[model samples]
Target: MTAITEALRRLPKVELHCHVEGTMRPSTVVELASKNEIELPTSDPTQLYRYTSLDTFLEIFWLVQSVLGDGDDWARLAYESAVDGAEHGLVYRESFFTPARHLDAGQDLGDIVAGLAEGCVAAEEATGVRIMLIADIDRAYGPGPGLEMVQRLVELRRANAPGTDRVLGIGLDSTELGVDPTDFAPAFELAGRSGLRRTSHQGEVTPPTTIRAGVDVLGCERIDHGLSLLDDPELTQRFVDERIPLTVCPNSNIRIANAYPRLELHPYARMRELGLLATLNTDDPALTDLDLTYEYRSVMDAFGYTWDDMVTIALDGVEGSWLDPTDAGALRARITADADQLASSLATG
Candidate 1:
């Protein structure tokens, strides 16, 4: 490997947009399906993730969700995701979990949180990679169920549950095409009142107005897949001025045909040029067949980013994270020190 690729791999990183369900190992999915007697479109693990469209991918995504029958499955998935992330240089992660799906499947919220918390605590102890949860409101289920999910989360917090304590926020995910961000305002408001942070998926396939609604109506603190922000100069300027962080998944966008069809045309580089606090992520590492290291290398090659530019993006991930000020500051300092040392070594070597 070149010095740049090696350095990127060694660099400490943070991921704020990964999905826990989407990170399930392919072998684990096959095993879980067998154990649960769940039928899948394909029994072959290699063939399970092949998808030509977003709709097809969601079909598989839900199929994987079906295999997770109880708290143990959720806990195992959480633990494995952290282990896999640590192998990829992850220092911290905030993963999105769709509780609505599990609840619809007859899983209890408390059990789900307990299981995930167990996995997170063990993973943190073993790998020193801090993992937090973001309970996602499935937009396809509409507003009432979304509101109920947030209320349940509030109740869990009130009870001082183990797993719920790590759930720092609420995120809107799944099938954003027909859904309006405004529809979930009441739920997000409840989350705000309950002391939960807010974020949502917008601008991947939707227009800039959806992003506006997420921020203005839903009070989103960060935006996921916000590629369409480039469409509105005024809105883009506001995001720049406000330093709203966007977690962009380049390969996922290309795979799903949402943004630019080619990696070279992706707006990630332009987003950085516009000073939009853009950070790279693997939205669904297992499904996308990518890791954070590959993302860093892809952007470097696509945008001709130097190691210093990579450092800037890495720091953006730290600053954009939901980590408390004290933890974020310490992480920033460590990353700054390590990155400088790497850059200095590269210069002299």
Candidate 2:
């Protein structure tokens, strides 16, 4: 690898917008499908991820959800996800999972949470990669299901369930076109009362006004796929002023054809330039066939970002994370030290 690519690979990464189910290895998906006698469209793992549009991709995404038969499957996925992320310089991750989908598939919520929690623990022990879960309510299912999911999470916490504490917050994701953020207000409020952090996927394919509602109505602390915020100068300015972090997945954006059709046209660098707390991520690393290191390198190459700029982005991720004050501070210090060393090496060469 070149010096720049090597340095980018060594930088500590904090990924805030990833899905646990989306992290399933293609091979594992096929293996699990065979073991469970689940019929797949194609037995070849490589053919499973082929998609022409967001709706088509969701078809495969939903299909993979069915292959997970029990808690052990979720645990294995969690462990493998952490190990894969660690290989790409991941230090901390706050991943999302669609509980309603699993519940609809005849899987118990407790088993899902416990298995993922167990896997996260094993991952931390094996790779030192800290993992947290965000239970995402599917927007298409409407607010009733969202409220029920929140209650389930509350019950799990009250019971002191094994993986319950690992769940840090709740999120809104999936098919944002027709769903209004305000529709989920009651659910978000319930989560708030139960002490869960809030975030939403807004402005990916929707208009800028959705972002405003996400903040004003849903009380979202951060936004995912907010590339469309630039359409509204006033709202964009407010986000910049408030330091609302936007987790922009460039590769995912290109794949979904939402914001920018080309990498060079991506708004990630512009968001940074305009002082938005923008962080890079691999939205669905396994599905997209990309990782955090590749994300950093690709963005740098496309935007002509230097190592210093990479450090700034890395620091933004640390600041934007939901980590507690003490832990965030320590992670920031560690990232700073690493950046300093990388800077020194680059200067010498």
**C-alpha lDDT (0 to 100) for residue 125 of candidate 2:** 100
Q: Candidate 2 on 81-102: residue-level lDDT in tens?
A: 9999999889999999887777
Off by over 4 Å in 2: none
lDDT of 1 by residue, 1-349 (tens): 7887878887899999999999999999999999899988788889888777877888778888889888888889999999998887888899999877778777888899899889899899999989999999989888998999999899989999878889999999989788878989999999999999999999888899999999999999999989899999999999999999998999889976555667899988899998899989999999878888898999899999988899888899988998989999999998899999888878887
Residue pairs with backbone atoms closer than 3 Å in model 2 (clashes) = none
Candidate of highest lDDT: 1
**TM-score of each model, in listed order:** 0.97, 0.97
- How high is the CA lDDT of each candidate model? 0.89, 0.89
How well does candidate 2 score on lDDT at residue 1? 83
